[model samples]
Target: MSRAYGDDLRVLVLAAGASGMSARAAAARFNIGIAAAIRWLRRERETGERTARRQGKPRGSHLGVHETFIFDLIEGRWDWTYFEKVESSF
Candidate 1:
């Protein structure tokens, strides 16, 4: 699973740990299994914040915004006159 998934699971676990609901109630509310909810809550209680982040390995698309492209644009990649006109309107 990805780090985002772990973060989501941690959020669910935190929801379960809060005083407003039972395991089944939490599971149904979140559309997860009761067993899984209990397990995650237990793991969070036992492991602390370390369990909320990524583990084991990396996989999937490495999509990211390129800093160089941003820098070039900031330094005037598009026509400076066009940007100047837009900025003046703002």
Candidate 2:
């Protein structure tokens, strides 16, 4: 996946705004998407932050809450075949 734009490019785009250039024009000039330019401009106007927002932790698995129960069941059946384990899981 593509990475977020850096502060340097954000500053350049915002500077274009200060110079009376439209967000779409700035985006075209910088080879970035118009929506990205608009969003970054909005972020800078609202919060005055040029840096990208921090990403939150990844979501936990749906089965995570049953981890202990699942592990215990497996530990007690170490000799079970893979298919047997799969069938028993249901």
Candidate 3:
């Protein structure tokens, strides 16, 4: 999906600051959320960027730290239905 608000809306909100308009007022004027207007204006002040940030966790950071060990165990003991003997192993 695409971003709901574009750079043009963000620019309008930020520009409203110079005209003594509050973020809340700008948000209502643009039909956007108040928090969104504040966040956009703040981003422009701090980073000079008026676009939404990239979402989600970054690449190459997997949760499977022990994946290799688990695969090795399965490959080395291909004949084992050992979970039946040691239920806790599963």
Candidate 4:
């Protein structure tokens, strides 16, 4: 996936607004997409900041919360025959 434009590029794009350039024109001038330029300008107008927004929530394992319980279950299952029976049922 492509990364977001940097703060410097954002600032330059927004400066077009101050010079009375339309979002579409600015985007064309900078060779960026019109939607991106419009979104960035709107963000700066609403939040008064030109920095890139954080993308999403931090990464984590789905099984992390049950790690200890899963380990205990594995350790408690002493017989290979029990595992084979469970696998066959599934």
Candidate 5:
């Protein structure tokens, strides 16, 4: 299934609303649809943490530090010119 940006935003809003105001009132203030606001409130009640996980520090960099390419680009290597040209071609 595809991602729902609206649902995600509603979840965030719901969480914030639960902390500050009544779910119905907060949802009404935000002008979110009534059904969606109720759904969000129920889902939050069911799960303390909504869909996404809390991000934490990872063991290592996924890209592993592309130092050589970055250094070459910074130092004005002639070979680097083709990279930009190729990127533009796409």
Candidate 6:
């Protein structure tokens, strides 16, 4: 889902809604998901905005917060068995 649905498609879907087509119908007409049509319509109706927003992960890994801990665990116990390291990390 790196690619947000194109504005070209959004326009068609929004046009269908404006012309009294159901989201399901518009989705079928445009070969998209019912939820996508529904969301576009709802956003237009509520906020009067029809542009696609940024999609996908907002930032880096959650485990970033534990970087130091992970590094210390691995470096401090180089001789430990894999199972021992795994058990200690948890």
lDDT of 3 at 73: 70
30-88, model 5: which lDDT tens digit per residue? 77666656766777788764554324555786545876755656576455566784584
Listed in order, each prediction's TM-score against the native is: 0.41, 0.57, 0.56, 0.60, 0.39, 0.61
Q: Alpha-carbon error at 12 in model 3, in Å?
A: 1.4
TM-score of 6: 0.61
- Please give, for residues 1-90, the per-residue lDDT of candidate 4 as tens digits: 578888788889999976889899999999899998998888878988778877777789998997886667667774547667467445
Question: How many clashing residue pairs are found in candidate 2?
Answer: 0
Question: What tens-digit string does per-residue lDDT give for candidate 1 at 7-53?
Answer: 66558657666766766777777777788677666676677642544
Better of 2 and 4 by TM-score: 4
lDDT by candidate, in order shown: 0.63, 0.86, 0.76, 0.82, 0.64, 0.89
Candidate 4: the clashing residue pairs are none
Badly placed stretches (over 4 Å) of model 6 are: 59-90
Itemize residue pairs with steric clashes in candidate 6. Answer: none
Model 2: ten consecutive residues of lowest lDDT: 51-60
Sort by TM-score, top down from the best: 6, 4, 2, 3, 1, 5
Clash numbers, per candidate: 0, 0, 0, 0, 0, 0
Candidate 2 lDDT tens digits, 1-90: 567888788889999987889999999999899999998888888998778876666767989998998788878987888788788878
Per-residue C-alpha lDDT of model 3 across residues 1-90, encoded as one tens digit per residue = 645677677778888965889889998898989888888877777888867777666666463896886677778776668664256356
Runs in model 1 lying further than 4 Å from the true structure:
1-6, 49-90
> How well does model 3 score by local distance difference test?
0.76
